[model samples]
Target: MDPRIDFLYLSEPDMIAAGVLDAKRCVEVCEETFALLGKGDYLMGGANHNNHGMNIVFPKETKFPNMPVAGPDRRFAAMPGYLGGRFDVCGNKWYGSNHANIEKGLPRSILTMMLNDKETGAPLALMSANLLSAARTGGVPGAAARHLVNKGAKVVSVVGCGPINKACFTAIMTQLEGVEKVVCFDLFLDKANEFARWVQGEYGVGAVGVDDTEAGFRDADVITVAASRLRPLYFEDEWIKQGATILVSGPFNTDESFLTSARIVYDHTALQEAYVEDAIASGNKEAYYSGVIGGPFFRLIDAGKLPALKDSTSLGDVVNGAKPGRADLKERVIFIACGMAVFDISWGFELLQNARARGIGQSLNLWERPHQG
Candidate 1:
């Protein structure tokens, strides 16, 4: 009997060649994924089948000299999922992150993804996933912008000037038309200035750097917050104009009053439920709320400060026409997207297929004969 097994290995360059950086196509694919999610055709890690992923975090202090202690953004994680539909595949993303990587001239997180055949559980492809991760992460907001943002929205305010926000801007540009300006705010003035210049050069939009967050949000039609923070960053209700949509891909900093008043939408309702369950089970509810981007809202619901989450709609529902998106120009909407593993699997699967069609990756033989069974 034939026993040969092989898998495709794709480096970052190969992933780029396979169209990993195609923001428009990535957004479209993400939309498809969201629809599948709404239909319950995906399975993520955890008992509830809606977990984001499993992470291994080190302690802040370790007695052993060889033992590693945790620092900011330092952890190892595995994000696994199965996405069914026309694209039936299972995959896992493995990444290690250390904030100090920046000091070494590298990104804080380095990631790789492995796609497998659902039926056989055989490796299909192993690929660099930093770009895949970024594109899919950005595509969530991009897809929301397509359905939620006001048409011909002219001004966009970006609160973070990091790589993730850069990808978000690229995805937003792909999905929206007539975006005339981008105002950026960052703690580091130089980073904000650099991002402003980048936006101007890349999208030819009028880009400005602002010292104050309020100035960044003033008169903005769409606001995206992608900043990484351990503590909440507050956005006063007065800063948000009527009819503006805020896409939150990072930790929320606003007060309870603003959240209760805004039309809240989630990337997926079940995922948020899972987050709350996990937080409660872990016994430090407040820490989870403060640490996670969408934690506060769920915490408020748990504390009876806000209504139950059933009142909110999932972006997937909107994509599938199961619910309405952006009822009126006067309505204020805030989209909270806690990144999902399905996105990584979906995009990785597509990239793998593209690489195969283009003959863009190396074929590595797993074995010529079965080692067991």
Candidate 2:
């Protein structure tokens, strides 16, 4: 047998060429992945097998001069997983994030993805993951929006106007019909205005930039929050229109009344289970989920104000028809997305196939043969 180990290296442009920018297709791929997740056909890091990823968790203070202290969205994490159900591939996405990178002309979170063979553990592909991650991140909520958003939703509010939300907005646009207008909310009016211009040009929707946070919520049929970590967007229950669905992919802060009353859904229950356990283990029960979009919901659960995580319907189960989504038009629903590696591995697997079929990516040899075998 030819004992050569080879893998594909896909650069950013190559990934784009492989249709990574096809938001509609990415959403379909995410839908399939979620169904697989609902079937219990996936493996991720940690004993629970559903961890989002493991973080470096830098200390708040360090004696050593070279050691880094934690900053906003600053951490390194390795997110690994194996996805089954026609994918049957193993992979991981490496995440390095620091908000300071913006000053250096770099993205806050620099990411790369690796795919391996399930049986042999041999490398299959290594590719740039910024777009891949963004697409899948957006695709999850996009998938949720399909089953959760109220019909004839006309206005979409984006809470964060950064690149992540840009990708999310793109994916969401593919699912929502008759979205006549887009309202972008951001701390910087210029950034919001720029994003609004892009939305108007790209999606042909009426777009406006709003400095007021309430404008992002009122009269909007769907609101997607992807604001930076720890930077929570807050609003009153009265601000959210009846039947509005909040798709939270980043930090959010709101009243307990909203949490207690809304029709809450999650990307996947198991991952959040891991998150809750991890947070409890940290000994600071309330610190971790503080500003996170879904954190407060978990907090209420711990306080016994909400149902157990198992009782809440997962977006996956809804996608697979095992549970319900948006039962009534007036149901105020909130779908919290705690980022997961399965989406990255699964989507990367799909794109790797496309790269292979189209003869894209560079083939490189890992070794001529095994050293001892």
Candidate 3:
């Protein structure tokens, strides 16, 4: 008897061919995953089973030989999870990141995803995860846009025009077909212009590089904030027009007044609540829930300013037709996507299947026989 194991390798281009980069499809899959997450049908890392990942950071003032210095955005991470439901696969995403890589003309992070069989814990596919990560990150917001953005939304604003934002824009457009103008704002003016150019070239839409956050926010029908800034990206509550939708993808510094009044929604309230509980358990009450966007929503719930988080629906509810989306043209809605590993695995598994069908991978044999025996 012969034993053989082969895994598919999906290059970025091959992923595109396999439809892994399709914003619309990615959004749909993420929506399904969100519903499963809401129903407690998933298991991530940590005792809580909702931890984002285990991060390893270097010391800030290390003087040891051959030891790396700790700096901004420099770290390694291991994100593992077992997602149930349709895909029903276990996987992990491991990556290392450093800000200095930008100067070397490379992405700040190099990442990989390992999909595994649920039964024997054998590896399925080891493929490039940068595209996987970006697509899923954007797909979360795309899922939100599908369920929340105003119909016929023509004007859009984007804060932090980076790789993540690029994918966000791609996903948002799938939901808002009438989007004809895109306004972009970044700390680096050049990066904003670059994002504008790409948008115009890709979709034939009018793209403008705006000077201020308010300018990006003003009168826009749909707004997405995907920035990586350590500080908060804020626009006065008065700046957002009625019926507009805002998709907050990263850390947000915003006034509580808007959060208390808006129709707030999240990808998974359980995960958001876990963060709130962690904040409380960590002994930092003031900044506990306030440090994260979801935390602020929870704080409002505690104060009775906002409705119960459970009442605030998930995008999956809308996708599954269990709840309504965009109640009216002028409803103010906010969707928070904290990101999850199940999303990556869902899309990654789909891509791997496609890669195999199209014969698009480099196979490496794991072993000719079982070493454990």
Candidate 4:
């Protein structure tokens, strides 16, 4: 065997050329990844194998002048996982996020990903992952929309007008047909109008910005909450249409009543359970509710107010044909996504393969020889 080692480096444009922005394909791969998760063919960080990942957080007060202080959406995180199936690859996504970055004309989170050979532990590729992450994040809801959305769904309600939701809208429009209009709401009306105009120009759909959050939900067939909220926003059950499907990609957007009344589905049950376990062990059960999108439901389960794990179903089960999706037109469904590292690994592996096929990325030498072992 050759002892020389090299790896591919893909920039954002290289990734796009390698089909990283193909929303429909991303959804298909995400569905397959979920099926593998259902079959127990994946390993994430932590001993339980379901941990989200390791996050580095700073304290609110620091004695050191150079040390960063805690603020909104500020932290460093490393999400590592190994996925097994047709694509057996290990990878980690590293990101530093600060909400204040927006003022400097940068995204809140800037990410990079590294894929490895599972057996040999050698680097295969290092790629810019902002688009990869957003596409996979949006693909979860796209997959849900494919399986759970009612037929002839005409209107889509979008709560947040950020880059993440832009990817989500692209995926949704690609997967679902007959989407006629988009009703959008944001804390900044200017942002909402800007996103609406983009949707109109990109998808050729009617887009409208609403001043009221409730107005955005009226008569909508699908609702997506991608807004950045530091506190919970309660929605009256009456505000939601009977057949509407709500996709939540952020924290504290809905309340316990809506969750209890809806047919709740999660990307994965064990991951959320792991969050609950961590919160309890840390002696702050309330943090689970405040920190996670599905935390309130889990808190209710802990309090015995809701059935333990019975009132909800896993999206993987639905994907694997073990459970049904959207049984009736009037059944309101809520999909809560906590964002998995397996998705990044899966999509990154595919992008790397595509880059190799298309001869798109730069090749960098890792070592001239195997110096150790």
Superior candidate under TM-score, 1 versus 2: 1
Candidate 2 local lDDT, 149-222, one digit each (tens)? 98789999999899889988889889887989899999889999999999988888899998898888889999
Each prediction's whole-model lDDT (CA) = 0.89, 0.90, 0.82, 0.87
Compose the digit string of candidate 4's lDDT tens values, residues 163-280.
Answer: 8888787777776789999998887799899999988998898999875778877789998888767545556677888989988887645556776778888888889888887888
TM-score ranking from best to worst? Answer: 1, 2, 4, 3
lDDT of 4: 0.87
Candidate 1 TM-score versus the reference? 0.98
Give the per-residue lDDT digits (tens) of candidate 3, residues 1-373.
Answer: 4666766667777777888778888888887887787667888887889877777989977769888889778999888989888789999999999999999998999989999999878888888899999999998998888778877788999988888888987888888878878999887788999889988998999999875777878898899988874566777788889989999887766678787667777787666766766777879866766556576677677888887766777776776677776777778888888877888898898788878888887787888887886
Q: What is the TM-score of each candidate against the true structure?
A: 0.98, 0.97, 0.92, 0.96
- Pairs of colliding residues, candidate 1: none
- Runs off by more than 4 Å, candidate 2: 63-65
Off by over 4 Å in 3: 1-3, 285-295, 298-304, 307-311
User: Which whole-number lDDT from 0 to 100 does residue 311 have in model 4?
Assistant: 50
For candidate 1, the 10 contiguous residues with the lowest summed lDDT are 227-236
Lowest lDDT block of 10, candidate 3: 288-297
**Residue 49 in model 1: lDDT:** 93
RMSD of each: 1.2, 1.3, 2.2, 1.5
